[model samples]
Target: MAQLSWAAPSAQALLAASDAVRNPDQSFGLINNLIEYRDGKQIDSSTLAVYARADRKTGQFRNLIRFVAPQRDAGKLLLKNGNDLWFFDPSSKASVRITPQQRLLGQAANGDVMTVNLAGDYDASIGAEEEIQDGERQKRASYRLDLTAKNNEVTYHRIEYWLDRNNSRPIKAKFYSNSDRLLKTAYYRHFQTSLGQERPTETVIIDGLDPKWITVMRLSDWAYREVPESWFQRDYLPRFNPEQAQ
Candidate 1:
């Protein structure tokens, strides 16, 4: 049998660049705050605590998110297993299937908060070399990338991504649907050294058609965590307890 590869040689280059810009470890924890704005007015906000573990060899990721703010939503849990994600409501005590593209708090998607490795979810290819403005409005050479989803589970069906030529860190990305309709644009900025690696700690998203609709995601509390293997199992979600795990 021939060995199967996820991306072509050209695509692999783009994937390498993406991997360099994100979490490169098997397990980690972070706190994410999602804020939404419309017409320059703040609309909504939410905070979540997330724990994620990835199988580096297989590129399989497992994530667990617990809502930490807005007392009403506190204690709600979301668990990701391979391509399937489930949401658990503490009050209802039910686990319902959910999609990554579904809005989480505002413009942030469930996948955005969970932070999956894009290299594993999409096949990427270098598109064009363009001079683009960075988050700071400084001009820089960037690699424009075309990313196609390998499976249906990804948050977006396609993405036009950009990376800095010098650092290989993600600069900006445009997410699209299967039909190629642009949905949103994201700017990765506020790079800082965290968990021993330099990575973007904030992402600003704007609606494709409505520039006034904006969302900002701020990531903090970066730490290496040892997630229990059993926490990744769907059967264990109902009884999972963060307090006892600590």
Candidate 2:
């Protein structure tokens, strides 16, 4: 694995620069609502509400949403405390508590799918810089980053990210399998700042495994506030938080 070096402007630098520029206030908390669409039709919709107080803060997230369409009665919940991750699925009434290793694996999987930056978990290298669109307006000084997972067991081999160089925000991401085949791609269409962080408001996930199965996420009416740390505990997952269980 390659370390992000300042001398050559590594991929991490580009990402950090983007984060700093887009989120000048440096607020770390955010809440997002996501909608998943397939074949130009609405198939599923959900909300990925998130909150982050700081870089290493515990109990920094909450994902509350109903996954409807392909699966009628499915809901997924994820809570993170620093390096720990807790995943809960309402349909199965099952919860999986993840260690640091598992957390890395989960982030790796998500990093492959979404253009959203995963802070310092995986090593990334800057590939190229170009100009792209932010909505209909054209922006210059965008960077391309190559992210490779340190763990070999994960499905994705490498990911290419096109980020806005001025702000280091990702506009598009391409994932490839171990055999160098394209796996999936995500496009970020809208962005907003909450808790001083720039997060995508509209996103699309195209699955290579099943091209027909496209997942779209849209964030709206975001609210940021303090949430109980205990909400992230695996043991408490079954209880469900009334505020988060819409």
Candidate 3:
């Protein structure tokens, strides 16, 4: 029952590994995400095109999401500036403040679809190590990471993250609230080469309270792109040209 304390080098390597899985590009990138929600027997899905740019100084990702599916949601936009997130509905012609905790559809939140690098927002320690079978039924040694939020900006207050000991590929994660209540569990799988790096293609999240409810986010079409500085400005939301995004 002895507790495990991670070494500084191991912790840094783990952080870098998690960041690599989340966003591989050293600077800027874009990806398409398809999200699906399931509750019992009911299922629903949405598609989004996301553009992400990293702040060289802070290492924070500035993301812009454009809904691209189900005619009704088309043209809607979500912008993330630091810790704050904003949603703009083309029909309403207004911008409203939103939080990462808010559900975008069903079980998935806005933060789940955005490009996030956990190393910047979390202070991680290796809490334990275990042997486990991955999605492909491959046995591997893995490290279970205990992560504490460095600040209030992150989506989850605390997290239990698991990653392969050899390659630093994330295997699973459990998200928790400030009160230490379990919120959800996510399994990372379907590793594919994107933007010249292999990363998880799908993240499947199951509700903590209702295990039958599940949400999935699929990432694809990753490309290294140039993101203009003007894109991160709040004033650009209204005038953000969808045509320019493509």
Candidate 4:
């Protein structure tokens, strides 16, 4: 008997697989903790609860990020519907348009927290396969992927992503601006079983211009929940009930 020969997976397949390793397929919620550091000293931190669901028509995730900690910021929400993003404050009861490029913390951008489907929004091409250092500083053999945004609404104009060749797990990524300037570098690590997949639980992001500026994002308490379509609308921001988020 002879073994069957097959061709390698396409770049798109690899990208989609990588996305699967990072995102859940169904409606879900998770706790996101952002810890900002500078020169190895902790400077700031934020806790957020993120509820997300993919749109049936576009396959893009609609996210409602609610601030959970830091009393001054609680009850605030950041809504990401398709390409539009808005910041809503309960105190003022006002919705203000915001851009993804805006920095949320030291090294974390507003776009970074939004639930996004990379494969659904970008064009991908295969790059070199090489040995690289992962988040844990361990040597890993990885495949490089070059991605360009399909539209202007995306967070980054371009991205260079590295995935574990053997498992298609995302190891690291470099984000770029429209002018091709490197904006940030993120390393995905601490994978754990969440909502049926081995998803990355922590992300270490380093500032493009300053190595000392670092933001560590940790995600936890993953669960499949009911995310209603009304939650994605700006008009429902004021009416959103926290108990329903549970």
Model 1, runs deviating above 4 Å: 1-9
lDDT of 2 by residue, 1-246 (tens): 234335556667676665453332222333344445556676545434444333334212222222333344345656554445556778688977643223122112332222223434446877766666554356645667888866663335677878865556668877776788886777776677644566666656676676666666555554444545555556777786545633
Between candidates 1 and 3, name the one with more favorable TM-score: 1
What residue pairs are clashing in model 3? none
- RMSD of each candidate relative to the true structure: 5.2, 6.1, 2.3, 3.7
Candidate 2 residue runs with Cα over 4 Å from true position: 1-8, 19-31, 51-76, 81-86, 89-93, 97-117, 132-140, 152-157, 196-199, 209-213, 244-246
lDDT of each: 0.82, 0.53, 0.80, 0.91
Model 1: pairs clashing at backbone N, Cα or C within 3 Å: none
- How would you order the candidates by TM-score, starting with the best? 4, 1, 3, 2
Per-residue alpha-carbon lDDT of candidate 1 for residues 78-102, written as tens digits (9 for 90 to 100) = 9998888999987877899999989
Q: List the residue pairs that clash in candidate 4.
A: none
Per-residue error at 142 for model 3, in Å?
0.5
Candidate 3 per-residue lDDT, tens place, 1-246, comes to 234534424775687777887686654555555555555564677888888888888878888888888788999999898888989988877989888988886678888888888888898887887877775678877888889999876789999888887788988889998899999998889998887778888877888898888877778777777777787777787788888877
Model 2, position 86: C-alpha lDDT score: 57
Better of 2 and 4 by lDDT: 4
Candidate 4 lDDT tens digits, 140-159: 88888899999898899999
> Over 4 Å off in model 4, which ranges?
1-7
**Candidate whose TM-score is highest:** 4
Clash number for candidate 2 = 15
Q: How do all models score by TM-score?
A: 0.92, 0.66, 0.91, 0.96
